[model samples]
Each structure stands twice: as C-alpha cells, then as structure tokens.
Target: MKQHLKRTAEYRISNRRMSKSGIASLSHFLYIRQNSLFDIRCWTFDVRRSLISFSILPG
Candidate 1:
C-alpha cells in the first residue's frame, strides 16, 4: 500500500511539472506573438504617416 502511494505521488509530481512546462511554452509563444503584433502596428502607423505626408507635399 505504501509503495502504491509513493508511486502515485511521484506520478502526480511529474504530471504537475509537465503541465507547468506546457504553460511556460504557451506564455512564451504569446509573448512572441505580442511583440510581432506590436511591430506590425508600428509599421502600419509609419506607413500611414508617410502616405499622409506624401499626399500633403507637391508632386
């Protein structure tokens, strides 16, 4: 009975570790995506500003 309990406890610990790792990976992916989205937003804003400036200037 004691050995069974020990094995169960070990399994639980390993399962928890695996879940934590999965969460870490998910958060890392989200971080990367957030940064890329920010970059895209900045790039678009710059393009819009340049377009406006070009329109205002004489051809």
Candidate 2:
C-alpha cells in the first residue's frame, strides 16, 4: 500500500500541478495505519502552497 501511494504521488507530481494537484496528490497526505484510519493533516499546509484544495472533499 505504501508503494501504491508512492507511485500515485510520483504520478501526481509529474502530471498534476498547483490548485488541482491536491486531488491527485491525495497519496501524499493519505495515511492508513494499523488502527485503520486515514489521517489528513497536511491539508492546511498543502493548501497554502497551492498544492491542493480539499474543499471539495468531506471536512
């Protein structure tokens, strides 16, 4: 799964750009641990850098 996220992140980095990259760059911020939960704290930082706009997703 980590490999998958890395691949997806790599792909997003190459294909997606600022503002729209967030959706694709989800791989970079997503986390699924042994506790079985996805945590996304990078949203604030990413948004400030124009790397993504998670406003569309559930808040």
Candidate 3:
C-alpha cells in the first residue's frame, strides 16, 4: 500500500512538470509562427511596392 501511494505521488509530480513544459513549448511555437507571418507580410508588401514602381517607370 505504501509503495503504491509513493508511486502515485511521483506520477502526479511528473505529470505537472510535463504539462508545464508542454505549455512552454506551445507558446514557443506560437511565437515563431507569429514572427514568420510577420516576415511574410513584409516580404509581400515589398514585392508589391517594387512591382508598382516598375510599372510606373518608362521603358
């Protein structure tokens, strides 16, 4: 009975640690995703601006 209780306590502790790390990793992924989206938006805007300038220029 005592061994079973000890094992149960250890399991709960490990579960909490695992969940905390999981949250941290999820937030990290979201941060990277947001940065990538921002970079894509900037790149697209630059491309559009260059295209417009090229069209405006005389041959």
lDDT of 1: 0.99
TM-score of each: 0.70, 0.27, 0.84
Model 1: which ten-residue window has the lowest total lDDT? 50-59
Off by over 4 Å in 2: 17-59
Rank order by TM-score, top first? 3, 1, 2
What would the per-residue lDDT of candidate 3 be over residues 1-55, giving only the tens digit for each residue? 9999999999999999999999999999999999999999999999999999999
Q: How close is each model in CA RMSD to the real structure?
A: 2.0, 21.1, 1.4
How do the candidates rank by lDDT, highest first?
Answer: 1, 3, 2
Q: Each prediction's Cα lDDT score?
A: 0.99, 0.60, 0.98
- Which structure is stronger by TM-score: 2 or 3? 3
Q: Largest TM-score belongs to which candidate?
A: 3
lDDT of 3: 0.98
Residue 21 displacement (Å), model 1:
0.9
Instruction: Report residue 57 deviation for candidate 3 (angstroms).
Output: 2.7
C-alpha lDDT (0 to 100) for residue 46 of candidate 3? 100
